[model samples]
Target chain A: MKLEILAALNAEREARRAAVLVTEIATGKQRLVREADLASDPLAETLAERLRMGKSGMAETPAGDVFLTVQAPPVRIVVTGAVHISQALAPMARLLGHDLTIVDPRTAFATPERFPDAPVHAEWPDDVLPKLGVDRYTAFVALTHDPKIDDPGLIHALRSRCFYIGALGSRKTHAKRVERLTAAGFTDKDIARIHAPIGLPIGAISPAEIALSIMGEITAALRLKPASAAQAAA
Target chain B: MLATDNDIMNRAEAWRREGKGVAIATVVETWGSAPRPVGSHLVIDDDGNFLGSVSGGCVEGAVVTEAVDVITSGAPKMLEFGVADETAWKVGLSCGGRIRVYVERVD
Candidate 1:
């Protein structure tokens, strides 16, 4: 690898920016492609597709077969409510390669011992959500079942365009939650982004099972047709 | 295949800086039923010690052999392993596939 390319890649890794290292197979010509560079590359269209999918693969171009090693930042998960589900979720999400932050104003449940190895915060959603830097590569999971705890975080997530937004509740509970979000000034489409009755319909009973379902949904949202590609296809 | 495991790139760079010759073999392309996804890496140090994997095991032996030469010659090379009837029989593959690997020196 060229020193310049390597240095550029290291800098991107430091800043947690998405980047791609494209290696031209025939001549071994290599260059770094940051997310912002996609629109200008000769292979812009294909690169855009690959970036949106967050995948690295061999792309056949007019020049040659170029191998793209996509390096998207690790998905950050802001899990509000350090409840039983979150206790199970923190480690599971970590095992699945996600950075997790547990936010709950209740210090008893959000203690370091309760969620060891994860960054725990005894701060409210409005206080901690901005500090977490929730972005497109982030996922927000609301498990508190309290509007005070979940609503602010969900609104922040919706505004930030985080890849996934999920809230825990029953169908009726979700309906009321929907009314609250609507009244709070979120559009219908924005309110629809929340995966109310959070997690998949897996008939999950235990906290661990519920956590597994949430992780599955989060992964699906991250890997399978991120909203940009879906909108492009639409 | 949805995730990259055991980051081999950083290990390769560190090994080279530590005064050991290192080569990295990466899966550049795959066809048919390949075991590993594209961009998977296997880092081989001068002593034939390797970390990470391009294939589960089916093609590591061949890729390592190429990586050794890349380390020795300081020249990168691309390797192609395709599913022939004999190769499928030898590797005990229930399916057929093709893999293209690029082996290059760390420095």
Candidate 2:
């Protein structure tokens, strides 16, 4: 590993860009492949598969045996409400190594005392989501149950490439939400991305159980294959 | 203070920039119930000082010693550790797992 290569890898991480450090095990030859360059690399297909899986391991290439250190950006959880579920979720998200942020316009709800482990923002989602830079690595959850707050955040999340978007609501509430979003010009296809009636069907009763179900769903969305994840979520 | 993978890499780059001979050991492969997953890192300096863990503190001491040698020789080495009884004299995982570690110098 050259000093320059290590420095470059660190720089890519700081910039929150995905990259892989390819090291040939036999000779110690190494190279850094940024996500943008994956298409042109000779090992493009294999690298893309590994990147999608977000796992680092030994790869047997026709050229040689190599190790790929896949550096996908850490997943960030952006919740639109600092309610009871968020309070229970903040700690769990930290335990799972995901960055969790709580946003709510209600000062009483978004108190530091309530969410000691997470950053509590006493602001609206529309005002904060942009600055948070919710990207492909983000899991956006609308838990406020307030259309004024959750609707704007949903719009932002839909426009961005956030991997997971869930909303806390029942089927009836989601129907209303769908109507509003449709009136707002979001096609049914774009609106379909949201996991309304949020969380997996675990028959959750309490707020903490609800949080666990939501977290479980998010983990499935992240780790499972797309087809499997859809099946699990369904 | 739990060190993330990024923190280990950052520390490795920082140590090298500070003019210290540094080596990084990574768990490249794992079989069975290995304590740490593949791609886990442990960065060491010439002085045998290390940060991070390739195997939940089970074989880090051995890795650090080899990493110091790799730093001095500038040649990467592949190291394997298995069950304690299999590696009678060597440090091994109590969890009955096998792991392959790659130790390389940062030049």
Candidate 3:
């Protein structure tokens, strides 16, 4: 009992250290803001007033009713296929603050020199993804166009709730892929979540153009509302 | 309260332990020469204590005043500032762009 009490106390202390709570007075909603201190911090006064009013939203601090809204730098992007599109996409994604990782069983394609800035994992998707623990913030793309590599990654991404999942293929290819996924027990809704025919319909032809489309779609997914909602709004 | 870099976490924790309320404001969307970028954040306590920033000091004073009211009334609000507004220019960001700030309480 004493040990359990000590553990509870430690957990409470850790939570307090990591998060600030903000409580909205009118709605009574509370949000946790991750703790961060950027000096010359412009948001300080605004946060204080919001706290006073009991407004609930995540901030980068732990004061008042303000809870911490933690932001991890270099958002993670995991690409399952190391195709030419992956090469172009990796660098472009890096420019926009994504920490890119390329995984492929093809030793020739997945190399540190080819993807210099990105972390290249020359392992099969089944072996790699489990260790990475893809989360809601991570973006996953299957560019191999080969079911042997793409299928397992798709299954993993679908199960884990990754923020963005795109596969490069034609509608016909996606249809065939859907058959495989359904046989493996993925529901219709789950299959629909995959952004196959990947990217905005900008009439992309080259590998670079395709990469741009994929990146644009992923960026929109991260910042704006869901694709269905965005279409509705438009 | 003024905070040193090392003391920020400790100060925030202390505030929470005292049962005080806190509010956060964020620059969710910006357009046409807004002073700050999207994802900028500001935090304030019920007594008007503050941390972080949203704008380039152009509308912080006004935001604080509004936050105080929000704290007292327990309401959330969205504030917009643009070059078209006289007060917005008076505060310093007269660059002729618009910014939307979302203010909410989180505790």
For each candidate, the DockQ is 0.39, 0.60, 0.06
Cα lDDT tens digits for candidate 2, B1-107? 57777678999999999999999999999999999999989999998888999999999999998998899899999999998886357799999999999999999
Provide the lowest-lDDT 10-residue window in model 1 chain A. Answer: A225-234
Q: What is the C-alpha RMSD of each candidate to the true structure, in Å?
A: 3.0, 3.7, 11.6
- TM-scores, one per candidate: 0.87, 0.84, 0.57
Candidate 3 lDDT, A1-234, residue by residue in tens: 022222332343343232233333334454344334432344557553442232334444444333323323234789988888988998887677576789999999888888876889999998999898786557889999899999999999888757788988899999999999999999998888799899999999998999999999998887675333322322
lDDT of 1 by residue, A1-234 (tens): 654565566567657688888888887788898988778988888887787777789889888788898877777899999999999998887677678899999988889999885999999999989977887788899999898998888888888868788999999999999898889898898887888789988999999999999998988887676665323442
Share of reference contacts found in each model:
0.30, 0.75, 0.00
True lDDT of residue B82, candidate 2? 91
lDDT of candidate 1 vs native?
0.81
Can you give the lDDT of residue B13 in candidate 2? 95
| Runs off by more than 4 Å, candidate 2 | A107-122, A185-192, A200-210, A226-234, B86-89
Candidate 1 lDDT, tens digit per residue, B17-71? 7888888788888889988888788889888888887777877877777788888
Residue pairs in collision within model 1: none
Give lDDT: candidate 3, residue B93: 54
Model 2, A1-234: lDDT tens digits are 999999999899778789999999888999999999999999999898887778899999998899999998877899999899999999898877688999999998989999988998899888999999987788999998999999999999988878889999999999999999999999988898899899999999999999999999999888675433322332
